[model samples]
Target: MVAAADAQNYAQKLGIIHGLVVQELGWDEDTNDDLRAEIEETIGSELLDEDSDEVMDVVLLWWRDGDGDLVDALMEVTGQLSDEGFVWVLTPKTGNSGHVDPSEIAESAPPAGFTQTSAISLGEWAGSRLVQPKAPSKQR
Candidate 1:
């Protein structure tokens, strides 16, 4: 979990992005509560929990190394994203107990129909934005 100012900074980051925010905030209770309260107050956007009819503009996913079965998780989330929507995969930073290697994200995201658009450091978390892969254009 991040400290108060770190939480504030994280909240500020999420605030800049516009749209419905779907969160699969899979952190343990401690950080989860902090982040939830922070983002909710700062972002002030509608959030969805499980899958339903609606698609969201942004998805915030909290991931950890060895949490279990990433392929399955990716498959599940891919359908939740709108055509232009993006997913931010937040993982613990290196040296943290549950940190996930960036190389693994680079390798796995594409196989699940996503492309890693950018990487960001979100206070205590390492964030990567994954988006729908661009289709190859037809030959003229």
Candidate 2:
């Protein structure tokens, strides 16, 4: 189990802040409850589900090797995201059950209109941050 301080830091590192609406998808028996708790604590509210109609500041996607098509899932989440929001694609870390290769995420992102921003280890999960690329600025 992760210490409270560490869990707090993890949530903050993911850009979660007070009052932010965060939607969570793909929760299952294997999902990390402690991490979810920390996120809820940071946001000062419960995580919303995929069915939520509100636009979300962040989307937490718990994915696995066999969880259908990654591209499709990514695309679906975008409709609920605020323009500046990002998605955290969390999968089991290497050698763990249901671990997904980093290469697979990299390959799937673009077709879904996202760019891989960063990745980090969150206990038993590897979290990959994905964002829609901002349009290039025009200069006179």
Candidate 3:
């Protein structure tokens, strides 16, 4: 019984984390709301099982096109978790360009322990936006 409960709890936690990712992708309002609710519920249910003195570590890696909004949302989410004795290790994603620097983001009052890491190339990130499937042709 205990094992089953643990499995269920882990699944719920995964769902919430996935929801946050979906929300970052700018999904529909209804879907976002539903996911947010599920995430909140899971967190509130003590699924994390952290003590009051525990510091939770969270890592966030934003895509190249991602802006401050992503960081903001991550901070908000981590803030909620911190209230329950969790600290976050946010790591914002940066471009692969040798000329591009990630320190700029870190200097802008990022969350404590937030690190910036080189992620997918900027060209790749931009190219993904352009590769959309075409719709079917209309019949005459």
Best by lDDT: 2
Per candidate, the number of residue pairs that clash is: 0, 0, 3
Cα lDDT of model 3 by residue, 1-140, tens digit: 24464444422433234322211322222222433355555445332322233344322223232334444644544433332222222222244332223454444324532333322222212111101123377999
Can you write out model 1's per-residue Cα lDDT over 1-140, one digit (the tens) per residue?
44576344555565434335656546564244555666665557545566455666667778888777665677687776777777778888888778999988888787788888888877677888888876787998
Residue pairs that clash (backbone atoms under 3 angstroms), model 2: none
lDDT of 2 by residue, 1-140 (tens): 44676444678778788889999999999998988998999899999997799999999999999999999999998888898999999999999999999999999999999999999889899999999999788999
Query: Top model by TM-score, which number?
Result: 2
Candidate 1 to truth, TM:
0.75
Q: What is the descending TM-score order?
A: 2, 1, 3
Q: How good is model 3 by TM-score?
A: 0.25
What Cα-based lDDT does every candidate model obtain?
0.70, 0.92, 0.32
Q: In model 2, how large is the Cα lDDT of residue 89?
A: 97
Question: Model 2 has how many clashing residue pairs?
Answer: 0
Ranking of candidates on lDDT, top first: 2, 1, 3
